[model samples]
Target: MTVTASARAASPLLDLVRPARPTHVVDVGANPIDGDPPYRGMLAAGLCRVTGFEPQPDALDELKRRKGPHETYLPDALGDGGTHTLHVAATSGMTSLFRPDTNRLGLFNGFSEWGRVREEVQISTRRLDDVEEVDAFDLLKIDIQGAELMVFEGGRRKLAEAVAVHTEVSFVPLYENQPVFGDVDQELRGQGFIPHAFAAVKRWPIAPVVFGGDFRQARHQLLEADVVYVRDFGHPESMTDEQLKQLALVAHHVYDSTDLAYHCLSQLSLRGLAVPDAPNRFLAVLGSANRT
Candidate 1:
């Protein structure tokens, strides 16, 4: 799912009005396997400046060539500034910092061979607190396969600057000893990042078998999902107008979070910083789209 900038540019859904100040992002494990990453949308709108991290050499090279003026890709993985082995898989998307829980994964269909680790490469890991390019960022987007918690563990202090986090979380232990959804939720709550919304969920059938149009009986099991965490939603007044505006753009453009967009728009409007006619129109578009 390689996303070209041109293809994304064609989609004005994310080209919502830019904020007064740039929305900064600290993206960890920013491998572009999951289609065009949200940072691209934020970048195109000139609403964000991103400092991304990716250890995969090929992916890093590709990013290096295509990175925009507001983007920077570091070839370091986020961790305790130590040497770690990457569990490379048969497919690039399944690679992770943790070993695969092959037994549990083999119970499913397309996911059975997802964690076929082909190689293990030693890599250097650095903590986000040590990075000079990042003073603070509004969003902290991470997708380091199963090591999402480890990154946060290493940079708990730095996370205080983040208002929102969009990260991948496994509902089951797809990888051995990996933190599950509960673990992630607890950690984020401890950091003051409340569960905002689920951007995506990857599920597999309960059992691999032919069904005679009895899909409801077959049932499905949750595998992994992209989870969104946000700072106190009740305390929007604590945020400046520009920060609220940046959050609004991120909510609408990156997450397609119309509800959050409405919240931000409301706050901005109350402070006389509305984005022209965005609040009402965003609601209208969402209403019409969901109706069908």
Candidate 2:
């Protein structure tokens, strides 16, 4: 499936933009039932059959303990879908599907900059293409830190099998010398995926204001949230160009304040830029909007 720029402008995620509802979802980097994993919002949305993959011992355990019949927990990393050495951070749960390096930390604003604690583990990897006769996915969310590119490469078959994808595209290099946005963008586009870059929030105060009184702070455009890739299936193409522009405008406007800011900052920081507001609040808004 391929997402068009027109569809991205107006729709929520690519899955939401499609004419049909997404029933099946695969959430990678799912927040642990005990510790923080990732993508808690997707689970709350009541997706049918979720398969979460985590490499951290504690987080993986929590995932297993909480996984019901509708959910499956895997302790392996999604690599080029084969056996590969995983660099388990001294912090454990911060395991990277690819080798750890300093450049990636730059993209994430030093989030994983603990400088690789002296501990390491050899974890197995699985390629999505290796799996036989798997069901189609409605939505696939991946946030494997710097390992996103590897997973995509291994999941080429699966990528074609899915309708929509929500991936964390960090321009940060996983290793000292690895390609980032430019490479992934080309790869995804080549695979017939339309990519939507998440936006960032603009600076605005949070003080409550009276509705019809003297409201000084009307919500202005803040940020872009997630870059969604939609396949060409199920999108309405007969809309006017003006309608498409409006749709894109509204879609960008919908990202939550803080989360959008965080996404924006993550993208910009790679180039050594700063966001105008509180990073926490910025990420929070985008996170909330993605939920909505």
Q: What TM-score would every model get versus the actual structure? A: 0.79, 0.56
Candidate 1 versus the native: TM-score? 0.79
Please write out the lDDT profile of model 1 over residues 1-292, one tens digit for every residue.
1334563363333334345445688888787887887667557756568888888889899988988877889888787778888899887888888887788767766555667888999887777777776776789989887888877877787787677899898877878888888888888888877887888877666545536755323346777888888876688866766667667766776787778878877777677665567678667767776798
Q: What is the lDDT of residue 155 in candidate 1?
A: 75
lDDT of 2 by residue, 1-292 (tens): 2334553443343332232332456766775432432334433333235667776668888778877655776666666755656666665545665566654443332335544746655666777666553355555777665666777787877676564567665543545545466776777776666765453222222234333454334354221123666543224243222222223222233222233323433333333333334344444645677799
Residue 262 Cα positional deviation in candidate 2, in Å, after optimal superposition:
28
lDDT (C-alpha) at residue 58 in model 1: 94
Q: Candidate 2: where is the Cα deviation over 4 Å?
A: 1-22, 32-42, 45-47, 102-113, 132-134, 197-226, 233-292
lDDT of each: 0.75, 0.51
- Cα deviation at 256, candidate 2, in Å, is 11
TM-score: which candidate is best? 1
Error at 37, model 1, angstroms: 1.4
lDDT of 1: 0.75
